[model samples]
Target: MTTHYNVQKHNTIYQVKDRILIGTMPPKAQVIEEAPDYLGNILKYFSKPRTLEDSFKFITSNSSLSEIEARNLVEELIENKIISNKKFDSDNRYSRHSLYFDLIDTPINAQEILANKTVGLVGMGGIGTNIAMNLAGAGIGKLIFSDGDTIELSNLTRQFLYHEEHVNNFKVEQAAKQLALINSEIELVPILESISDVEIFDKYFNECDIIILSADSPAEIHEWINSAAMKHGFAYSNAGYIDSFGAIGPMVIPGKTACYECYKNDGDLYKFLDNGQELPSNLNESFQAPSYGPLNSMVAAVQANEVIRYLIGVERKTEGTRLLINSQNYKIYEEVFTKNENCKKCGHFTHHTENLHASFQESSLTDVYVNERENDSFNSILLDSMMDRLIKVLPNTKILDIGCATGEQAIHFAQKGATIIANDISEEMLEVVNNKVNTLELKGIKTLHGDIVNLNIEDKFNYVICNNVLDYIEDIGTRLSKFKGLLTENGTLIVTIPHPIKDGGVWKKEYYNGRWNYEDFSLQNYFAEGKITKSRENKDGETVISSIESYHRTTETYFQTFVQAGFKVVGLFEPQPPNIVAETHPILFEKCSHIPYFQTFVLKKE
Candidate 1:
């Protein structure tokens, strides 16, 4: 099989006295006579269509270059936009608007810089849509966009990307479709869902060089974004209008300039920012004010310009500077933000004790439960059976679920009129749980965003549930002791884990040496060579696949650990599969009936 690739002819070339030059309009000449001979021939092979394998073969055979050198040269040309005809960039589309950027510092290829950079545009509102256009025209390599909005009939005034036909269509999809028509060369990924959570932020923004926040979100979300930018070390800019006042502000570079909180001196905004904690979850809807299209364009264009400047490594004047514009009179002014020593986001701050724990890479526990594990009847059956037993025994009792991410048990008990307290290290999970509580209109439910192992609370609870959380903890006894202390006299603790014999530790498929060696797998812990480690795919909704580290423990250890924590196993239960499992997955139901996947226990303080 043969592959044909062509270099973009839009770039100029010059060959003079054993020297070769290639670039936009005017080629950048390199004296290759005294340099490596392959440097000159790099352009020759790229001049016509050739397979990647043959191109390497010709280069190494014709010149004194190794296989790596030839490959690197080809990659460099593509990165520099010299090889536009490569199968990768099939559009073969030449950038027509290169003069403006080319004149700035006379870069060899400004398009290459934009081609290599990725920008995440949040919100497909008037500002977000306009910025997407500017970035797409500027030849940004990729634009990752999100907007939790549908095109409204009124949006035509500012959101020029859509027409009446697009009304009620998802703003992101509509904008992406329009932008692609403008520049088919640019890679566009429409984030169908709005990014409102920290884990979601990491999933999207980890690859972006800069984040443009124009989402019609709350001030607290902006503050939360500031914290995330500081934590992730990515630059983010705030640009858009509130009513008629537009501000292109204080683009933040973590560890470099003053963050959003530094300049946003409004006391109401800083009340929660001062402590690095989020404002009340209910405040998400109270911050936005609609503005005209002109104001959104003004702010978005300015933000887009700064985003490009940041990506190209050019000195940005807008960092820590907010340019305010009043569209009524078209008057513009600048305000600067400086580093605040007490700025909670990028300043000296200490974490609360309960907040101190192994920083686990949080995935959507609830999403995972609902998507993959929920269909398994044992999961729901186990929870329902436990709740039913307790509902009869402990009416109006308070319950705690430690390491609860998007609490299933908490919501269940809360709906049953029990006061349920939930805690987890992932703040985003708690945010979702909070939203659930609000939407469900359930009462007596509270969530703590911190480590469950070091939970900070005083009220004695009638029951505590720890499900699948103990497997992650190496030092479980201490946390167990704390949970026991939180219970009233004779209070019960419900625990659930995978049955050991039923679901043995994921044993290595093919092992060597001895039978006792079955506990470890292939990827042994470096520090402890004999012991194995495990990871599971706990994340999705991103181009990059992310996984979470997990600990493997035997079911016997769970029982022994509880008994050692001064608790007696009063009752043990292995649930029968619901009828739905047999109906949907009969084979699985049969296997489960033989050795159920889950083991539940009711423990009482001795």
Candidate 2:
């Protein structure tokens, strides 16, 4: 189809399939000289962005332009901004961007489809490779794949991206090459390392719009990602396949969703069954690993589908929690759970380190690329145990987490089988949480912009937990009362506060980051209500200074305030970081408490 256009004095007509007369561009305007001569051809092909490659192939096959000439024309037009080269920064191997089935072909809206999104895959093994392919074919704008391992011959059966020639190449890089071949429009970034590595995590976690956790990492990694995602406020998704039958889906939606910990504790009914004990059944023989095709493909497709729904804003009733696809039982199951009110990282004590690579501070790269969500390793065992205990008690319950920075607790709760609403005053924090929530393909989780003093939830929840928040507000009573309207009839409110009388008031010192240097406290001023200044005389400026200038209240004061608020204290728990004693017989400075030192008040509304 030859599309001809004549530049006139009053109107400029653009011929694309049908003549598109853009009345806005004045007729006498100078044409962008760099626009491709075959723009009509490109536009005809771009009627559907997915068929871009096929259009190019068709045009080159018939026209006098060589393949290289056709590519140059497309590039020139894109560079001139006359047309979008959706495939500009990509490499296509299997299909072109203009070739995917439109939303009309499925029960989806094409307009709702996100053609410009970047998603990160943490591993490029059987599962990660499959996930990358599915997302790429779906028209996601950019694909980032991470894997430290090199492609091995054994990985050939399931990891299709690696050919015999790619035997020793980094799995992620090889996968990127293959993925690019499939859809050049999809930008591929290869990270050759584990997601848990500080360098890799910091580089990709916040940059990518979404992340999929598919590596067989340690249990700590699951919590780390949960906390990091919540802290960074990114959307994260995790899917697992076992015995070719059991599948688990956990998604964290920032502040307004259940988190990974929530699902780990609540959704997996058979979770922690042995509790470090011997295996109960001889299913070890029957539980042999299953075939990779069905498990990998089905799970990856589900993950991709969920990503699409999140991008389109097609709200789901089940926003946060775990979906159990049990082909073994021939029954699909789902569970709603709540947050561990005492979660160290997501709870009152501020488990978030804010600086992970402390030891590496001397390294110039450390300052440039270190994870901010580093937590103190001293309390890992206690916090881990406490999280288990808390989840075991609540099992699964609807929860509202107040002052939820980055919705990490919400993500944990959602993962544990709870419906969660993660709320915070900072929009930046909420944004990060929402990104991870969308990535996870979770249900029953939501994020809201709100202050603890004025919560705006219409529905009441079985539990409302506020961690490390009460101490920051001056009007504790008034701020807490707002929760009354949001709690269920018999709901419990779990509050964590630093015991006012503990260890000679508040201690302030510049501790080393998990790496070697100090923290970047610059962006915090906009979020926190107080300013942290360096006092030359005082040293370290009293870290944890009250956000609102208020007198610290002792345990008695807290109890009195609750009575007036019409809440009865059911449980008073304290958390103590390892090696730091709550007190050494009240007078000495050596002994930490055997019990958790920070107080967790579990209260019930009258």
Candidate 2: count of backbone clashes, pairs at least 3 residues apart or interchain: 85
TM-score against truth, every candidate = 0.40, 0.38
**What lDDT score goes with residue 127 in model 2?**
73
Report how far residue 465 has shifted in candidate 2, in Å.
53
lDDT per residue (tens digit) for residues 147-209 in model 2: 789887877877776789999888877777788788787677887667654445666767666
- What shift in Å separates residue 422 of candidate 2 from its native position after superposition? 51
Clash count (model 1, backbone only): 1
Give lDDT: candidate 2, residue 358.
15
The segments of candidate 1 whose C-alpha lies over 4 angstroms from its true place after superposition are: 1-96, 266-288, 348-606
